[model samples]
Each structure stands twice: as C-alpha cells, then as structure tokens.
Target: MKITFLGTGTGIPQDGRVQSGVLLDTGKNLLLFDCGCGVLGRIHESGYEHKDIDAIIITHLHLDHVGDILALIKANWLLGKTDMRIYGPQGTKEWFEKTLDVYDYLRDRFTVEITELSPEEEFIPQGTEGNCNCNIRSAKTAHTDNSLAYRIESSHKTVVYTGDTEPCQEVMELAEDADVLIHECSFPLGFPMTNHTTPDLLTLMMDEYPLTAKKLYLTHLYPQMQGRYREATDHIRKYYKGEVIIAKDLMVVEIQDD
Candidate 1:
C-alpha cells in the first residue's frame, strides 16, 4: 500500500501545506481519507487522477477535514465517474445530505453511497470487485463526538491513521503494532491546546501507553509547528524509540516494506 500525504496542514493556512487529506493506494483501489480544503488541487498536484478514488473514509466532519469533499465529488462527476462509496462515523450520511442540500446543482448528479460506521466495526467497502485487498477498522477518537481513528491492513502490513485527536487510549490501542501511525501533531511543544495534539502531549501518551509502530509520521500541522519540526521530533524521540517524521505535502510512504 502506498500512502501519500496530499495535504498536511490544518485549518490554518501555510506555505507548502494545505488542509487535511491523505491517499492510500492499495494498488487495487485508491482510498482517500479526510478531503479537506485544497485537497482537490493537491490530488491533482500529487499526480493522482481525482477520478481514480474508489472510496473516501472520513475521520470526522470538521471543516478542516471535510472541506473539499463536495468539490471532489463534483469533480468526479465532471469526469463521468459518479459511483462512490464513502464510509465514516455516525453523522456522515446526514452531513453529506446537509452539505449537498445547499448546492442545488450538485445534488442528484451522481450516485453516492454513504455508510455510517461505529467503533470496533470492520468491513471492506462495497464496490471492491473481488476479495477486498485490505481490512479496514475504526475506533473512537478524542476529537468530536463522532470522531474515529482508522486501522487499515493489507496482506503484508498494517497502518493506522488518526484524523485529529488528543492523546487518548482508544486511538493508541487502534494503532498498536501497526507499521506506521499517521497521527496529528497539530501544535508545537509547550503549546497549551485541547482536542488536538502537541509534541509534549503525544510523548506523554508515548511514555504512558506506548505507540508500538515501527515509524510515526506526524501530519495535520498547524501554523504553530512552522519552525519547530526538529524540536518536535526531538521531544517525541525522548519517549518513542521509533522514527518520528514530520509529514509534508505529497510525501509518500510504501506500507508493505517501509
């Protein structure tokens, strides 16, 4: 599986970064996670055809995460590819409906299948041709009321993507023993925050609960993390022995052997 960080920034704007979005190329199909603002352009910039996305899995409904979802769906429709299956936490169906309700021209232009998922539930997306190439699971996260952390496993490797979360045991357990944990380190060290992560808060989770992944890639950065990349990694390394990387836009990771 190839994971691409299409947009690594948060709601705040910054140079060389957009909002939250990532792509997992399963080789069979492309699984898109969190299509936030600027993700559509980033998808094009990343050399990925927007129409090739088979499914979109959302972690939450925050604007920073779901901002570009409508634009993407409309883009696919323009490309004559309208069939899409989207899976997400509880308010997903309602959110999509409400979002589309405001756009009179876009509604009924495509066939969208939205599935509402719950913690601990696992399933393959409906449109996979044969046996699903990967197993996808979700766990409750400490962000919004319906936020989720996802665990995706191909035959060879497992990866966890934490959308936007604070240091929480449920997300930690969801990431246990995965090859890479793509977590949100939204702030820099010593930045007092809530419902988001900082290097200090993440390491606190590391020291207490322990992230067992071989590598940890931090994304969903706020402007606060602008020049603190090295310092953040240094702080995390004090508790986590694995490689700690600050993810950038368009950075790619192959899960099978990374």
Candidate 2:
C-alpha cells in the first residue's frame, strides 16, 4: 500500500500546505480521502490524474473536508471518467444531492454512487468494474456526531487515517497494529481546543493507547502550527515510540509488507 498526502492544511491555507486530501493506493485501487479545496491542483502536482481515483471517502461534511468533491467529480467528467463512488458517514447522500442542486450541468454529467456508512461499517472497495480490491473499515471518531476514521488494508499492510478528531478511543482501536497512522494535529501543544487535536491531548491518549503503528504522520495542520511544528512532534515523541512526522503536501509514504 502507498499513501500520498495531497493537501495537509486546514480551512485556512498556509505556505506549503493546501487543504485536506489524501490519496491511497493499495497496489491495485486508488482511493481518495477528503477532497477539500486545492486538492484537484495538488492531485495534479502529485503526479496523479484526477480520473484515476476509484473512490472518495469523506470523514465529515465540513467544508475543509468535502469542499471540492463536486469539483473532483466535474474534473473527472471533463476527462471522460464517469463512474465515481463515495463512502461517507450518515447524511452523505443528502449532502451530495443538496450540493449538486446548485449546478444543473453537473447533475447529469457524472454517475456517482454515494453510500452512507454507519459507524463501524466494513467493506471491500472494488474499483469501478471490479478492477481492484482493498478492504476498508471505519470507526466513528470524535470530531462530530457522524465523523469517522478509516483503516485500509491490502496486500498484508494496514494504514489508519484519522480525519479530524480529538484523541479518541475509537481512533486508537482502529490504529492498532496498523503500519502507518495518519492522524490530525490541528494545533500545537498546550493549546486548549475542542473538536480538534493538540499535541498534548494526543500524547495523553498515547499513554493509554500505545500506538501500534510503526510511524505516525500528523496532518490537517492549522496556522497555529506554523512556527511550532518541531515542538509538537518533539512533545509527542516522549509518549510515542514510533516516528512522528508532520505531513506536508505531496508527501508520499510507501507501505510494504514485511
């Protein structure tokens, strides 16, 4: 499995980061998570064609998470790719319909299959026309009432992606024994916040979870992490024995089966 950080910024953009988006390739299928604004451009920049995406998994309905979904579908339509599948938490179907209502031209341009996933739902994602197979399971995270984090496994490798959440037990359980954990660290250490994660809060959870992943990459960075990126990693390093990296746009990590 291979994972690429397409966009790692927050609702607000920063210098090197764009918005929220990650591309995962489980050697056979290409899956996308969170197509926020700027992701289409970043997908091109990351050497991926927009038409190659097999499915899109949304963690929440926030603008920073689902902002560019319609744009992605439109771009794919322009490229002659019609089949697009979307898996998201409850209300996803409603959100898609409401979002496409404003764009009449887009309503008939592409065929989208939107599946509303319940908490703890698990399934194998067979690419369009059954081209590839990747098993995916999701657990509800602490971001919102319907937010979720995903665990993707294929070819004997596993990776967990926590969309946008405070350190939560469900996320910890989903990450257990995963090769890589792509979690969110929205702020620096000691910053008091809710519905988002800080290095301190993550570390507190780490003491209890003892992450099983070999590496932890933190994404969804806010502007508050501007000058304090290294500090955040350093603080969490004490609790987590694995590598902790602050993710940047276009960063790619290749997952190999040992």
lDDT of each: 0.90, 0.89
| Overall local distance difference test of candidate 2 | 0.89
TM-score of each: 0.97, 0.98
**Residue pairs that clash (backbone atoms under 3 angstroms), model 1:** none
Query: How many backbone clashes does every candidate have?
Result: 0, 0
What would the per-residue lDDT of candidate 2 be over residues 16-130, giving only the tens digit for each residue?
8888999998766799999999998999999988898889999999998998889988888888898799999999999999988889777778789888897789987657768
Best by TM-score: 2
Give the 10-residue window scoring lowest on summed lDDT in candidate 1.
Answer: 124-133
